[model samples]
Target: MRYLPIDNQLFVQNRQRLAPLLKSKSLVVVNANDIMPTNADGTMVFRQNNDLFYLTGVDQEETRLVLFPEHPDPKFREVLFLRETSELIEIWEGHKLTKAEAEQVTGIPQKQIYWTHQFEQIFGQMVFEAEFIYLNTNEHTRAGVEVQTRDARYIDAFRQKYPLHHLERLAPLMHYLRAIKQPQELPLIQTAIDITDKMFRRLLGFIKPGVWEYEIEAEMMHEFLRNRSRGAAYTPIIASGANACVLHYIDNSQQCQDGDVILLDIGAEYANYNADMTRSIPVNGRFTARQRAVYDAVLRVMKEATQMLRPGNLWDEYHREVGKVMESELIGLGLLDRTEVANQDPDAPLYKKYFMHGTSHFLGLDVHDVGNKYRRMEPGMVFTVEPGIYIREEKLGIRLENNVLITESGNIDLMANIPLEADEIEEMMN
Candidate 1:
C-alpha cells in the first residue's frame, strides 16, 4: 500500500456492524480481486476488493476472510487466510505479510490466521455447521461484469460440493453496510479530495492553448502519486472543446484550443477511498460570454441540487427535484423553449437534452460506490453533486461537481474550499 497504514479498529468496527445483520449460524466468505492479465507474461496492478478491505483492512493478493459467527469452536468463529511467502516468491514479489503482521493489521487473532494452502481443510471443518453460507460477488448496479471472479468460481464449486447448504448473496448485505461511511473512512476520502484540489490548482497554471489533453492527464497522475494516492479512482475524462459533450470521453488526445473549455471529470484514490470531482475551466484562463453563461447556469443548478442531499430524502424524489431545478436553468440559458418544456411528456423531461446523466451518485471506495438507490438519504452517506450543460451546436460544455456529506443538522460541501465561481477560477489561473 502506497498510503500509510490505517488503524485496524475501523475494520474491527465494520465487522461488529456486520455480525448482527447476518443470518443466524451464517458463514460469510470474501476473496481478494484477481490480478488482471495484460498479455502473455504480463499482468495489471492489483487493487484490493473494496468490500474485503472494508471488513479486514487487508490489502494484498490471494487473501480470504471467513466469518463463522455462530460456530461452536472459538477459533472457527473468525479466520483469515493468506498466501504464504516462499523464498522464490519473496525474491520476485517482495515480502508478503507474516501471520503476526496480518493479526496486527486485521485485528484477527494470530492463532486463527493460516496459510491459503490450509483453507480447504479449515473451511471443511466449519461448513456443515453453517445454516447459511453468504458468498460475495460484484453486485454494483452499474458494474459491467464479464470475466468470472474468484468468488464466482468458489460459488460454483461450493454448490457442487455441498449440494444442500442454503446459499445467500453477500453482495446485498455488503452494499447496505458499505454505502454508509464510517467516521474514519471520511478522512481518507477528504485526503483524496485535498490531493485533487492541489492538482486542480496546479493545472490552472499549466493549462494553455497549445497543451495537449494527455499532458494534463499525465500531470494529474503525477500529482496523485506524489501525494501517496494509488492513482485515479476511475479513468479520467480530460475532454476539451466539443469533446466535453461526450460524457465518458477518455481519448485525451486533443490539443486544448484557446477558446475551448476543458471539462475535467477526475478523481484520486487514497487508501482505497475515492473522491469524485468535476471542474470545467477555460483553456486560456478566461471564459467567453457564452461559456460563462452556461457555466453560471450549471453552477446554479448544482447548488440547488446539493441542498436536497439532506437526510430522509428519497433518491427518486431527489433526482426529480434536481431535474426541475435544471429545467428552470435551461430555460434561463435560452436552450429550451418554455412552451415546449412545459408541455413535454412527464416521462421524458426536456432538460435532459443538455443534462443527460444523473445529478448525483454515492461516492466512496468505488467512484460510483455501492448503495441502494431506493433507500432514503441518511447521515454518513456521501454523494457527488454534478450538473452540466452540453451544447454540441456551439461546441461548448460546462460541468461543476463537489462531494457532499449528509449530516443530522444538514449536508456539508466537502469541496467548498475549492474554487467554483467563474471569477474565482479565473483569478486563480491568472
Candidate 2:
C-alpha cells in the first residue's frame, strides 16, 4: 500500500457498530477482491474490498473476515483469516501480513487469527451453529458486474453447502453504515482532496495550446503518484475541444487548439478513500468572451447547487431545485429560452439539452460512492457538486465541481482552497 497506515481504532469502531445490526445467531463473511486477470500470465493490480477494508483494515489478497459476535466461543467471535506466507511465496510476491501484524492492524486477538488453510473447518463449525448468514457482494446501484468476483463465487458455494440457513444481503447494512462519514474518516478524505488540489494547480501551469490531451493526463498522474495517491480514482478524462461535450470522453488523442477548452474530470485516491473533481479550463490560458459566459453560467449553477447540500435535503428534491437554477442559467446563456422551458414536458426538462447529468453524487470509497438516493441528506454525508453546460454545436463544454460536506449549519466546501474563479485560474496559468 502506498498510503500510510491508518489507525485501527476506526475499524474497531466500525465492527462494534455493525455487530449489533445483524440478526441473532448470525455470521457475517466478507472476502477480499480477487487480483483480476488481464491475459494468460498478466494480472491487474489488486485492490482490497471496501467493506472488508472498512471492517478489518486488512489490505491483502486471499483474505477473509468472519464476524460471529454471538458465538459461544469468545475466540471465534471476531476472526481474521489470512494467506499464510512461505519462503517461495515471499520471494515471488514480497512480504504478506504476518499473524501478529494482522492482529495488531485489525485489533483482533492473536488467538482468533488463523491461516486460510484452517478456514473451512472453522467456518463449517460456525455455519452449523448459526441460523443466519450475511454475505457481501457489490450492490452499488450503478454497478455493472460483467465478471464474477470472489465474494460472488463464495455466495454460490455457501448456498449449496448450507441451504437451510437464512441468507441476508449484507450490502444494505453496509451501505447504511458507510453513508455517514465517521469523524476519523474526514482527515483521510481531506488528504485525498488536497492531493487533487495540488494536481489541479500543477495543470494550470502545464496546459497550453499545441499540447496533447494525453500529455496533460501524464502530468496529473505524476503529481498524484508523488503525493502517495494510487493514481486516479477512475480513468482520467482529459477531453479537449468538442470532445469535452461527450460526457465520458477519454480518447485523449487530440491536440488542444488555441481556442479550445479542456475538460478535466480527475481525482486522487488515498487510503482507499476517493475524491471526485471536475474542472474545465481554456487551452490558451484565458477563456474567450463566449467561453467565459458559458463557464460563468456553470459556475453560478455550481455555487447555488452546493448550497442546497444541507442536512434534511432529499436527493430527488435537491436535484429538482438545482434543475430550476440550471434552467435559468441556460436561458441566460441563450441556449434555452423562456418559452421553450415553459412548453417543455414536466417529465423531461428542457434544461437537460444544455446541462445534462446529475448535479451531485455521494463521494467516498468508490468514485460514485453508495448511499440511498431516496433518503434525506444527513450531516457528515459528503457529495460532489458538479454542474456543467455541454454545447455540442458550439463545440464547448464547461463544468465546475467541488466536494461538499453537509453540516447542520449548511454545507462546507472541501475544495474551498482550490481556484474556481476565471480570473484566479487565468492568473495562475499566466
lDDT of 1 by residue, 1-430 (tens): 7898898999999988999999998999999999999999899999999889999999999999999988999999889999999999999899899999999899999999999999999999999899899999888888899999988999999999988999999999888988889999999999999999998888988999999999999999999999999899899999999999999999999999999999999989999999999999999999999899899999999999998999999999999999998999889989999999889999999998899999999999888999999999999999999989999999998889999999999999999888889999999888
Which residue pairs collide in model 1, if any?
none
Worst 10 contiguous positions by lDDT, candidate 1: 137-146
* Model 2 agreement with the true structure over 1-430: per-residue lDDT tens digits: 7898888899999999999899999999999999999999999999899999999999999999999999998988898999999999999999999999997899998888999899998887777889899999888989999999999999999889888999999999999889989998889999999999999999999999999999998999999999999899889889998999999998889999998999999999999999888999998999999999999999999988988899888999999999999999888978888997999998999988888799999988878988899889999999999999999999998888899998889989999999999999899989
Look at candidate 2 and give me any clashing residue pairs.
none
List per-candidate RMSD values in Å: 0.7, 0.9
Top lDDT model: 1
Q: lDDT of all predictions, in order shown? A: 0.93, 0.92
Error of 1 at 18 (Å): 0.6
